[model samples]
Target: GAGVSQTPSNKVTEKGKYVELRCDPISGHTALYWYRQSLGQGPEFLIYFQGTGAADDSGLPNDRFFAVRPEGSVSTLKIQRTERGDSAVYLCASSRGGFGHEQFFGPGTRLTVL
Candidate 1:
């Protein structure tokens, strides 16, 4: 199967609006991750899901940010009450869910909150 993929590629929204970013991981990958990268900054981990359950979510900045991998392959990142500071590149990655396995990253979704 192909590598991870994200939808829309880019998004523009006004403050206080809501948005949903989608990610499609490679087939058979059990570990999926979400990250956010600000301008000139490294990507920050937001959440990790193993199969259909979230294995780690402590990196989520607040309750307004959430993610779900309902079917264990496709995931969605949801944002509520968007803010200008929320503008960033939302990246998705996937791995084999094994220790020492390398994670493959998607092209990312550039979100601009105006």
Candidate 2:
């Protein structure tokens, strides 16, 4: 029963670079979600996956961001052409399935675009 986990606890990159953040959800979790949190702001949903398919990716800011969950468990968030504006805490969470259940969150990967 591993809890959600995110890598790099902190990341520093230049204005135009690429980064891939990884997430490992709890075992048996069928739902995974990615969210970004700006300083002092609440988490903004980026993408959500149910089983192996991405159920909702509407919250993705732009083409620079993408995610995948092929095995219905672990997931990765990739950001292309990183920018200072893209700097934020990338949070990963998982639940039983739907919205009603509580989501367990990781410590988050803090992305800093210099």
Candidate 3:
């Protein structure tokens, strides 16, 4: 894709279910990130991948959330045992360099847990 694109624009799942959100970053972007946004708040970083390896994932809330960028261009965020509190918008962004670079964000995938 030319710009960042995320699949399954909206997802509604029951509590304890598993969900996978996909993000396709712009080609040749060296940095990819996954963030979650709750109501009335800014996006919170979940993971940051420099190329194919995760450089920093300190912001992830718990073991239930994981993100991977195996081939570097595309990434997926997997959430296990989803809860009602986990309902939020999962956002994906890409940048050109390691850190402090301008990022292009995709339209987030809205996850709703019931």
Best by lDDT: 1
lDDT of 1 by residue, 39-109 (tens): 99999999999999999999999999999988899999999999999999999999997776889999999
Full-model lDDT, candidate 3: 0.94
Give the TM-scores of the predictions, in the order they appear. 0.98, 0.96, 0.96
Ranking 1 against 3 by TM-score, winner: 1
- Candidate 2 residue-wise lDDT, 1-114, digit = tens: 678999979999998999999999999889999999999999999999999999999999999999999889889999999999999999999999866888999999999999
* Residue 36 Cα positional deviation in candidate 2, in Å, after optimal superposition: 0.5
lDDT of 1: 0.95
Point to the candidate with the largest TM-score. Answer: 1
- Residue 64 of model 1, lDDT score: 96
- Candidate order by lDDT, decreasing, is 1, 2, 3
For model 2, the run of ten residues with the poorest summed lDDT: 94-103
Error of 3 at 9 (Å): 0.4
How much lDDT does candidate 2 score? 0.94
Off by over 4 Å in 3: none
Residue pairs with backbone atoms closer than 3 Å in model 2 (clashes)? none
Ten-residue stretch with the least lDDT total in model 1? 94-103
